[model samples]
Target: MTQFIVSLAVFLALHSIPAIPAIRQRFIRVLGRRPYLVLYSLASLAALAWVFHAAFQLDYVELWPPSAWQAWFPLTLSPVAFFLLISGLFSANPVSVTFRRGDMKPGAVVSITRHPVLWGFLLWAAGHIVANGDLRSLMLFGCFALFALFGMVMAERRNWSNPLNASTSIIPFAAIAQGRARFGIDPAMILALALTVALSAWLLLGGHAALFGTDPLAMTST
Candidate 1:
């Protein structure tokens, strides 16, 4: 538990560095933008690996056994979560391709939420917390949920100075209703969405157990 907590702290701390503009900028300046990004990515992966190692080593300490129906929660939500993730991958937002292509217009995904990836992570984490009902799972998933929620807030604040992004929102379809963003889906995005659904199905069926040592489907059977 001590190692788990420490690993979690290290992961969160590494993530928090980007939220601090001065420190992030200083690192960028000192290391150069590309090198800084590379190093940060490597460090983040290391911290994430430590977190997973610690988490998987801990025995299941149940907080409350999930109700039978709770087993379906994550299963049902996984497709939607994957959709958001896939859409976010293709969305023209500050984080992905738009970072390089400054002139790119917001797409269907961004029309729903400026932070689609974060929303995806939020849903994935929240759904797991609802389904697992274990102390270790709660702590692991809850951290991700909070990180996604707070990261969205931070992202919005970071882009606040841009007039075009000013009216964009974190809430789904809010920006579209406000006339700040529009939805346009191309064939490529549609294909990506289909692939994401297939991947989600694969994960829910057996990939999750193979990777995490827990079968969500077995929970339903019991």
Candidate 2:
């Protein structure tokens, strides 16, 4: 629990960097853009690993007994969540979360939501909270849900004045529906879907149990 809190704090702090442009620019100016981005990305991954490590150390105190539907909910949502996660990370997405510079275009996923990564994270967190139904899981996933919500709001508010945002929106597909944004496939979207499918298959076929000590398929069966 102590470790979980500490790691959560570090994760929150690290993520907050992107929410603050001044701080991010300062670090970029000092480290150089590409190096700063690379280092930050690595640190973000390390912080996430620490969060999972610490969370597994927590005592399981059930808030509600697990149910088949509960477990299945997250499993069902996992593909879409991961697809958004991968596609958003891969796209240039000048309007939202992006890991690298590209052709200055928001990809197909971004046309759905400028904040696809955050929406993916939100779905992941909310689904897991329902699936696990435990204090530890709540703490772990709840923070993530809140973070994703906060990120979406912050990103929208911060970028609201930018002309690029005129073509995008916070709600999924709203921009495209309004004809503000156009939808088109991205190479990254294809790769992301392929990777998500492989990942989902592995998780369903006992890999999740191998890593996390529980099987969603088994959970749904019981």
Candidate 3:
């Protein structure tokens, strides 16, 4: 537990550095943009590796026994979660802290929510924590949920000039309805959606069992 807590702290601290503009700017100036990015990625990966190691080695303590109905939660929500994950990857919104300028218009998925990746992580974490209902699972997934939510808040604070800033709500389509943003559909978004659906199918079939030693479909049957 101590090691796990330390790993989580290290990971969060490393991630939070980029949220501090002055420190980030100084680091970028000193290290140069490319080198700074490489160093940051490496450090974050190392911290994540530590977190994974600690999590896998930790003994489980049952916090709440898994409810039969809880098993259906991930099965139902994972498609939306994975869609958000993939769509966010393809979105070109400048407001997103993870924004990568792409050919696609910064709408559609961006119109749904500017922070799709974080929202994806938040959903994934919430679903798993509810299904697993154990101390170790709670600690692992709960940390991710908190991290995702915090990252969204920090990113919004850092990019106050975001076009959608006029609307304070993070709910899907809220900005669009308020005329703060608009939706556009294109080939890239189509590709992202198709891929998300395929990936979701693969996970639901046998991938979940192969990776996590449990079949979501079988769980649903019980």
TM-score of each: 0.76, 0.89, 0.76
Instruction: Indicate the residue-level lDDT of 36 in model 2.
Output: 86
Candidates in descending TM-score order: 2, 3, 1
- Per-residue alpha-carbon lDDT of model 1 for 1-222, expressed as tens digits? 899999999998887775555677688779996888789879988998899899878898888876778878888877777787667755555532221123466556666776776787788889899898888889898998998888877776677776656556678778788887776686536866898878877887899888788788888877
Positional deviation of 44 in candidate 2, in angstroms? 2.6
Task: Write the residue-wise lDDT of candidate 2 on 35-132 in tens digits.
Answer: 98899999999999899999988888989887788888898888889998888888777656766453365677878888888888898899899999
Stretches > 4 Å off in candidate 2: 18-38
| Cα lDDT computed for each candidate against the true fold | 0.75, 0.85, 0.75
Candidate 3 per-residue C-alpha lDDT over 1-222 given as tens digits, one digit per residue, 9 for 90 to 100: 899999999988886765455667688779886788789878978998798779878997998866679987777767777777767755665666332443345646777777777788788889988888888889988998998898888787878786556643477678778887767676557877898788878877888777667888777666
- The regions of model 3 sitting more than 4 angstroms off are 6-53, 102-107, 167-169, 177-180
Give the lDDT of residue 12 in candidate 3: 82
TM-score (C-alpha) between model 2 and the true structure: 0.89
Q: Which one wins on lDDT?
A: 2
Better of 2 and 3 by lDDT: 2
True lDDT of residue 81, candidate 3: 77
Worst lDDT run of 10 residues, candidate 2, spans 94-103
